[model samples]
Structures are given as C-alpha cells and as structure tokens.
Target: MIVEHAVLRVRPGQAAAFETAMAKARPLVTVQQGFLSIEVRPSCDDPEIYLLLIGWDRIESHRDGFRQSPDYPHWRALLHHFYDPMPVVNYYGRSIFHD
Candidate 1:
C-alpha cells in the first residue's frame, strides 16, 4: 500500500467550515478505484493546520486515477478554497517499522 500525506493550512477562522467541507468531499475520493482509507486530524499546536493521511493501493491511484477522475472537480470545489498557501502532498511506500 501507499500512504499519501499532506499538511493542510487552512485560512484563519475557517477551520469549522473546512472540516465540514472535508466531510462532504470524502465520498468523492472514497468512491475512486484503489482507495483504501483516509484520516484528517487537526494539529494540537496549531488548530489552523490539519494533517491529511490517505491510504491507497498505489501512487497512480491518487495521481492518475483520482486526480484525473470526474469527481475531482467537485472535490476541489468543496475543499480547495479553505486552504491558505495550499498543501504539499507526498507519497510513501510501506512502513519498515510498525506495531
């Protein structure tokens, strides 16, 4: 499996709206092929910052499959505007250490 990680920096005072949007946007991504699971968490140090972790079957599942799908636009519309500087997404391979 592959792990997709991104730190979302939301605009000030938009955390609640962003979380609502994310919840609405979840179905768009979850319906894609190769999707595994996703988790979103707010930072303890900074509430404006959120951690987005997604599990996929492969890197292409996100970059090529989901991003290229018809649902992408809806997903973007729902959640993209809340971002300040925008998030930087990265992918990771299987973990070397885990419980």
Candidate 2:
C-alpha cells in the first residue's frame, strides 16, 4: 500500500472553513479506484496546520487516477483556496518494520 501525506497550512482563521470544506470534499476522493481511507487531523501546536493522510493501493492510483480524473477539479475548487501556500504532497510505502 501507499500512503500520501500532506501538511496543509491553511490561511489564518480559516481552519474551521477548511475542515468543513474537507469534509465535503472527502467523498470525491473516497470514490476513486484504489482508495482505501483518509484521515485529516488538526495540529495541536499550530491551529492553522492540518495533517492529511490517505491510503492507496499504489502511487499511481493517486498521481494518475485521481489527479487525472474529473473529480480533481471539484476537489481542488473546494479546498485549494483555503491554503496560504500550496501544500507539498509526498508518498510513502509500507513500513519496513511492519509485520
């Protein structure tokens, strides 16, 4: 499996709005092929920072499948504006220590 990670720095005072928009945008990604799950968490130290983790069967499932899909525009429209600077996304493979 692959894990996509992003540290979203939302505009100050817009965390609530961002979270609400994320909730609405969740379904867009969830319906994609190879999508497993997603978790969005707010930072305790920095209110404007959010951690987005999404599980996928492969990296291409996100880089190609979702990003190329028509749903991407809707997802981008809903949440992209809340970001102060664009988020940098990274992908990880399974943990080496995992059984």
Candidate 3:
C-alpha cells in the first residue's frame, strides 16, 4: 500500500469548523477507485495542527485518480480554506520493517 501523509496547520479559531467540514468531505474521498482508508488526528501539543493519513493502492491512485476526479473540487472547497499556510503532502511505500 501507499501512504499519503500531510500535516495540516489549521488557522486559529477554525478547528471546529474544519472538523465539521472534514466530516462532510470524507465521502468525497471514500468513493475513489483505489482508496484503502483515511485517518485524521489532532495533535496533543497543538490543537490547531492535524495529521492526515490516507492509504491507497498505489501512488498513481492518488496522484492521477483522486486528484482528477470530479469530487476533488468538493474536497478542495470543504477543507482547503481552513489551512493557514497550506500543507505539503508526501507519499510512502510499503513499510521497511512491517513487510
């Protein structure tokens, strides 16, 4: 599996709205072709930060598939505005030790 990771730095006073929007946005990703799973967690050290992890079948599944899907606009609309400086996403392949 491929893991997509991002550290979302939400703007101050936007956490509650961001979480609500995320709930509405989850379905947009779930219907994608190669989606495996997704998780969003708030940081213990900073309430305005969140960790986003999405599992996909391959890198192309996210880069070419979901990013090009019709639902992407909706996803962007629901969540993108909440970011302060925007997040940088990274991808990881299968674990080195977990096999």
* Best-fitting candidate, scored by lDDT: 3
Per-candidate alpha-carbon RMSD to the true structure? 0.8, 0.7, 0.9
TM-score of 2: 0.97
The residue-by-residue lDDT of candidate 1 on 1-97, one tens digit each, is: 9999999999999999999999999999999999999999999999999999999999999999999999999999999999989899999998998
Off by over 4 Å in 2: none
lDDT of model number 3: 0.97
lDDT of every predicted structure (CA atoms): 0.96, 0.96, 0.97
Off by over 4 Å in 1: none
For candidate 3, write residues 1-99 as lDDT tens digits.
999999999999999999999999999999999999999999999999999999999999999999999999999999999998999999999898965
lDDT of 1 at 74: 96
